[model samples]
Target chain A: MKIYIPNSAFLGNIDPFLRGFDPSDPGTLEITANEKWIAVHPAVLSMITALGLTVKPENISCRKLEARSRHYLVRMGLFRTLGISSDISIMEHEPAGRFIPITRIRTSEELSNFKNEMIPLLHLEPEQSRTIGYIVSELAWNVLEHSGSEHGAVLCAQYYKKSNSIRIGIADTGIGIRASINNSYSAETDLEALRLALKPGITGTTRREGGTEQNAGAGLFFIKSIAGINRDFFVIYSGDALYKLLKSPAARPRLHADPFDDRHSRAEGLPRWSGTVVGADITLDQTAGFSALLDAIRVTYRDAVRERLKARYRKPRFI
Target chain B: MRTIRLVEKTGAFAENKDVARALRVDELMPALERGEEVALDFTGVDAATQSFVHALISEALRRFGGGVLDRLLFKSCNEPVRKIIGIVTEYMQEGLAPGE
Candidate 1:
């Protein structure tokens, strides 16, 4: 038996091959490129294998894979990191920066190792590397806390020296933003859920569920605030909704949420991402003071939260 | 005065468990009880998240109240880490509010 996905089955395709895959059936997973150009995200294969599917890159065969973008190389690196063989020599090449190999962070040891390995690649000072490590840890931890994906999460990173930016991409094939937020609050759409998730102190966990101690719903909000440290951008995709938080120097940052756009358009009509993918483009400014930047964002977030709470409770703000 | 260096116990990747092990509130309680000031030196630490900061400090705040913050000193925190510590402190303080 064999399972194959042809063409550019990117992130938007979600689980193109796992709709009704039988666990009992012994089948080989194959990804064949029918077109001259093909692009695949790291999450696609990581999530599939995490869900009990035994698809190793060595076991899987690829045919006529061509690169239209660096994405092709990154995807190949992702598979190669999983001990799969490919035509591309990721070790010898550095297109933008090296891909940290799409990996599943399940245990504390694994997560720590991933962070340690990724930081040195940034080649920043001790203080600068730690800051990025902290941000990555919080985002990856969200997969364990919120996603509830049986397969854990898929994470890959790339640093573009020309752009002076580092991009960390993390995806999880779990109950998405809507399902997670809807667990406690009434979120009807993915966009609404994402919006609510961005709000500080808003979490899907309830009171009896040990919510406050485990989380204060401040992770993503902090990520959003800090990504603008040197005017970086943050983007999140889940379900049919795509969210982008853009940073500007002259004006305040803006968040645009669109239910229609998934950053990819398929003429054959693929499915929306069933999970969550967060891509953060952080501009590398070694001289910038993160403490001062954090203080500013802290004041802004506190004021916003205070104002919202004041309106909701109709009482004096006491903080 | 006892200075607890974070990097000594945990490497660059500091998590909630790492913080817990680094600063055992139960063990530190005796020091606080003995009127010894505890300074958390985050000099070699790469980065720390809100969760890691909150885990140990929140417990101390709950056990010793706002007075603990005075005895508890955070030193050598870089801009990014200092910011996270500040956020966690503020959040824990908010949780101490009346009927919050």
Candidate 2:
């Protein structure tokens, strides 16, 4: 099938994704397939699905990114997408999969509902839930505030037992991370904006009504921390440039590596991407310290959100 | 477009002589009956004194009835001035008075 994945696919057709190269522009695929179809990576299938394409798991095409490939960094902790010709396998496609499309409009009330209703279903501890919910809110805020589109975005999360992993994706056609940040830092050159976004305190939030710094420059950083805690793999694609936190720093935390080591080549062994459509993904094993990490974050957020509400409402003092 | 000339001005929309929130919408009902391309230009007009875009658009759409809302247009929308118009138009369907 001539499936049309989003031009933002985390690791879809790569040759054209490199900067200065338009995503719609085509490039030769290294693999030529027929018969049982191409054995593709799980990342490709997901990117396709996010674009609102329909592909049977059985037709999953497999292609591998070289360890040195830019897309390679995003492959952290994620299991390869396996073909499922029949539903008979122990792994079943989630029933809610098709209903959740990328780029859906959501209200603030719905955001609250996600925190209250779905968090429990995920069975994560309090802190885990808090951090997850916060991350979810950040993603929602990013879409509502930045996506130029009317419908913002809809998040689709699924759990696959076969590999004991959860895959979550957030997609939007908004001004994208690159465009929005560029607008914020008009002084910086294009390359400079990309580098600045990687730093800890450079969040690009100025238009927020009250302008809370706690949230302003911290979304990406917090999201990255959560991923690290989960020991999950991640991909961040924005403005013809993609950065993959492939291996969770936790698994092989970035402690020993020399940040100053400029031996040779661009971004040694890290994931790379080149696309304007913005988003990222992560894969983590349940065994990692996810349970404790999530618990701590959830409790912290639970207290914070609770306290904020209490202060705002004042307990409706009874005479 | 069903236009409302607000009787007074306030926080956001002020200075516009042609339209304001407290306008006699009843007076504009007949103009809409003519069913012509309507454009609300806030020229020489300052900010809208009161928030009437939502109510006005809702009523105009209802009076003009079918196939005309999209044809209605606006010009010179400042951020707040524009916000009222956007809130009304963007959520037009949802913002419709419940049963109406």
Candidate 3:
């Protein structure tokens, strides 16, 4: 079987790989570049590789894979890691930024060692190192908490020293934000799910699951706030919703629904991303100290935290 | 008089499970039994999450009441680490039962 990746606005076009996949089939698989110019999200690439890994096929190869762009380089690394290689110069091409290859965090050991692992890769100072550390920690924790993907979560990050910025991406082939939130409350649209997920106390974790004490549904909330305060760009794409928060001095965090298409009507025009991708791009120069960033969050949301705690503790444990 | 080095127990980026494993309640009972104040040293830890902070300190708060927080001193916490410990500790104190 051969899968062709397109050079489109986004890799939302790559969902067809999950179709008709057979675990026991021994068929050889090939992934190729379908267009002259190709760019893909690490989340989509991770999902494709994960699908190929799951079907347990005889062999996998990348044919005519182009490593022109930085994104493609990372995807090449991912393909290489999955034992897929092409007889092309793509392997020799270096990605534009210092890209951390896609990582799989399944065990507690991997998750705990994330900071130590990424620090040298990031080559960040103690302060900037701690900033990304907290960000990635919260993101990884969310994957373990909500993403029901059996294969675990995939993470990729790129540091652009020249631009003084870092972009970190984490995705899981699990139930996306819509399903996770709609399980508790009725979120009729993907945009609604994305919106609700940003609320301070709106967590998908339930009372019976020991969520009250462990989760305050503040992970994304904190991420959103920190990105905004730092004047950075943050994007959360899950299910059919693609919410991007571009940092502006006077901007309020708002979900700009896709004006081109409405999510509720099933007459599909664009393909939907299968999993959750939380991508952040923060400019290092404008970034505050990691501790001050967290402190700002605490001070800003202290009232919100108090309200959530009151609601959580007021309920009886078993009733 | 008993000081637990957080870096020795957990690495720079400490998780909740790691924090729990590093400083189990049973491990601290001996120090408390000897009437020694248990101080958690954060000399080498770079960052901590709220959940990790809560997991590490909640047991102590439960065993010795909110006042036990006073006996437990955090040493050499960086600004971010201190903020995490402070936020979690404050919330835990408020959520405790009236006497606690």
Query: Which candidate number maximizes TM-score?
Result: 3
RMSD of each: 6.3, 18.3, 6.4
Estimate how well candidate 3 is docked, as a DockQ score: 0.36
- The better candidate by lDDT, 1 or 3, is 3
Q: Which residue pairs show backbone clashes in model 3?
A: none
Clashing pairs in 1: A130-B46, A130-B47, A291-B79
For candidate 1, write residues A83-191 as lDDT tens digits. Answer: 5455654444545454555677766677877876766766776656655676778877888778887667777665556666656777776788878888789977777
What value does the lDDT take at residue A174 in candidate 1? Answer: 77
Off by over 4 Å in 3: A1-34, A39-44, A50-52, A57-63, A70-76, A90-97, A178-193, A206-216, A251-274, A308-319, B21-36, B58-66, B94-100
Residues B34-61 of candidate 3: C-alpha lDDT, one tens digit per residue: 6678888888777777667755775566
Ranking by TM-score: 3, 1, 2
Chain B TM per candidate, please? 0.83, 0.55, 0.85
Give the residue spans of candidate 1 off by over 4 A: A1-63, A68-76, A81-97, A126-128, A207-211, A247-272, A285-288, A312-319, B1-5, B16-18, B21-43, B62-65, B75-79
Model 1 chain A weakest 10-residue run by lDDT: A261-270
After superposing candidate 2 on the true structure, give the runs of residues whose Cα lies further than 4 Å from its correct spot: A1-103, A116-128, A187-192, A206-215, A248-319, B1-100
- Model 1 TM-score (2 dp): 0.73
* DockQ class, candidate 1: acceptable
State the weakest 10-residue window (summed lDDT) of model 2 chain B: B9-18
- The candidate, 1 or 2, that scores higher on TM-score is 1
Best by the lDDT measure: 3
Q: Count the clashes in each prediction.
A: 3, 39, 0
